[model samples]
Target: MQSTKLVETRGLTKRYPGVLALNGVDFDLEAGEVHVLFGENGAGKSTLISMLAGANSPTEGTITLNGQALAFSSVADAQRAGIYTVFQEFSLIPTLTVAENIFLGWEPMRGPFVDHRAMRRRAHDMFEELDFPIDPTAITASLSRAQQQMVEITKAFHGDLSVLILDEPTASLTDREVDHLFGFIASLKERGVGIIYISHRIQEFQRIADRVTVLRDGARIGTVAMAETDEHALVEMMTGRAITEIYPQIAHTPGDVLATAEGLVTSGVSAASLEIRAGEVLGIAGLVGSGKSRLFRAMMGLAPRLGGKVTLKGQDVTRAPTRAILKAGMYYLSPDRKAEGLDLAKTSNDNLALNLVMGGTGVSRMGFINWKEVRAESARIADYVELHAGYRPKLVSQLSGGNQQKVLFGKCFGQEADIYVFDEPTVGVDMGTRSALYRLIQQLAEAGKAVVVISSDLPEVLNLSHRMLVLAHGRISAELSGDEMVEELVLKHFFDESGAKA
Candidate 1:
């Protein structure tokens, strides 16, 4: 491992018309070191990385590489300069084979002829080097999110990447997959690759990062050695407050059955059905690709309902589309908040007012969007959710994860839905924001709304759920309620051999 500075940025600043996206930030990446960039959403981490990737040019400041100043005109230029970035969104084409995507532009050529065999061999070798078993000939669409991520990383590192940028690489990965990714990163570091790692999971940072840098509201807080600071102290510097409690439990009396499904079946599952009671939080837990998400989508009509009878408030409603199901007082929040919930390209006001405008409130007049009415209702929901800066007209991508979730909740709060289905609502948020979300969910139940929180986080499910269901291999393996809230019981019931048969 070399002790040379591979990349450095000084006085980096980027400003929009109304918001300063990145303040005069100073950052450096040493050769062969894994440096984690820690911050909340909209903490300017993405902007900084975007600039580094040559996706966006910095409004001010200078970037130096290996004691020489560098200017990249585009992402291609950045890659040519030996810097590669893997964003949260997989860059692989879903319809293309993994090998085709890996050698997309730089395929090996033999005497002016494309060498397909060489391409596949190199791609397979990359996977083998990383100890990943993904098939290079398989279509990218057939691969799971984790597999797709591996493909993306392989593509990024196929060539010489002196500095690699990974944004939330493990957010969608399972524990095993995360371990694999970390192991690959360690290998890359040993080979003298500097990595700029970004993640919301603070616990993992201490495990992998040699040094840590904190940014808040577009300004650099400070950079420190990982061994010198703890996650709590780092969070305090990032958010300016000590977060003691992440999840706060609230009590509520259960009410009547708000929703029920009979013989529900979708393409993703066989015979499946469930019921949700008013003021009840049903926690659903499962591994990735375990059909837990499918069940939620089927209930909300996001998936094709093969066979089912859904009833809301005693009204028989079956085989309805997403719009109809939502109209019938049911709503669903996606785990992918940025891609599915918020419109990163649009302003916060528009994203928060999406349901209101679509539902034809005063915001919609004769199929026309009334900007004034939309803005007014958005302001109300933003206040209710206590969003910072009271309805930021800025883009939704420019907000923190906790704050973005607040906007998502604000959008849904405007709709009068009797049942709310939340899928991984706290996936990438911090402890404080997660606690606030739990409080909000409790408030929703107290207001007589039946809530189904689908999450993989065991502690989150145990703390917030009144009743819990475990889905194993597209089937409800276990159901526990009332006094049966022990984590050990849930695990054994969900994974034990007899539990599978039972």
Candidate 2:
């Protein structure tokens, strides 16, 4: 493949307070190829891309395009220079139509007013060209993650994009949607569009990467052709260790049922029933909108149960509110760390002690709480989860995605809940952090704490769960235990059990 250099970075460096996000590193991208960037969370993968996409100005180094040095002051500057970035979190407005979101602030105008018809027509054309069926007039909030992703990608293509940067593009997409996205990317590559892809899922590299670059501790570890390196070698490069087994699910006998849901129904779920037992992980597997999350939320009374009962610790909590359910020694941890899980604006110590500080009996007669106790308790949980102590004082917003998640785990560790419900616990975390979280989960089960892990990653559920429950269209399609828990069988229920219903 003979291609000219489209973008290049020389001795790139980024410094933030005590952190060195990116070291003096040299990187380059050529036209018509997919170059994957791999690293653990906080490994500078995003930092490097932020520089390339002009989201951040580098404290040091130079950027070049077409053999000429270039500097970008803002995202608009990057877009004008033919660079666009699609972030993991969306930028679409919930109430606006798809076309409205596509154009955003720059609507197609006729003299002094906006031309809604022309904008919708253009959006429809872009969707057709990508072989996707996203309705331009559909509400942006009503579209599925895959459809929204199409809108985001189209927004980039709407511009004269010479280079595209996608961060965790397939994180929320189903397998079918993933195939569609891959094909779309292939077409972009054929058009001489240089794509910079970043993902924690190593399996994705095998599908789309031409060349893979590994970053460790803000420095380039190595760059290798995708055809030449295996997943093992890639993991070894990203983490300075040879991880023989990523999932070390220790075998243990499950104890008595700690929590039970009987005919539970929620907004997304029609009817679901299951039991969570001590010393075992009850795995929940389903596609997006399949009600796996709703089932858990309903179980904890987070969502109103229209009918049926949830017996937690032999006590009926069907009518009990979420606060009471948690008081009953059951806790629900949201997979979304930023919104529902932790306060990104607060210090890690505050986020860690959020629950205890409010719920505990440490308030003084003058209404002054015990600060030392909170700090000690927070530190202990952080140490157990392997989070850096230096990060305890930093705002959660400053920590990496993986560390912020650790803070969530730390909160649960302090509470010592009897039944722990984790939804997509390892979504964007790196391979090393994943292994650590896996161990922490196994340890919890071994300690006789009941666990339920709801995840889109089938491999994660199959490995950690003693029993698996596959949901489809708000119903339990199949329940597998012992030797019946395989990926093929579990996924079959995700489709066959759900059928084509809502």
For each candidate, the alpha-carbon lDDT, in order, equals 0.83, 0.86
Please give me the total number of clashing residue pairs in predicted model 2: 0
For model 1, residues 1-502, the per-residue Cα lDDT tens digits are 4479999999999999989999999999999999999887778999999999999999999999898998889988898889999998777788989999999988899999989899999998988887888898999999988898888878776557899999988888877788888988899899999999998888688779999999988899999999998977887888787755555565657898878877777775656667798888889877665677898788778787788687878877776678887888889999888778888888777787777877776743456677788778878778777787644788887766778888888778767798999999888886557767888898888787888999877778888888988877677777788788888888775553322322
For model 2 the TM-score comes to: 0.88
TM-score of each prediction? 0.80, 0.88
Model 1 global lDDT (CA atoms, 0 to 1)? 0.83
| Deviating ranges (above 4 Å) for candidate 2 | 16-18, 89-121, 131-148, 267-271, 364-368, 498-502
Which 10 successive residues of model 1 have the least lDDT summed? 493-502
lDDT of 2: 0.86
Candidate 1 TM-score to native: 0.80
Q: What lDDT does candidate 1 reach at residue 415?
A: 75
Q: List the residue pairs that clash in candidate 1.
A: 41-400
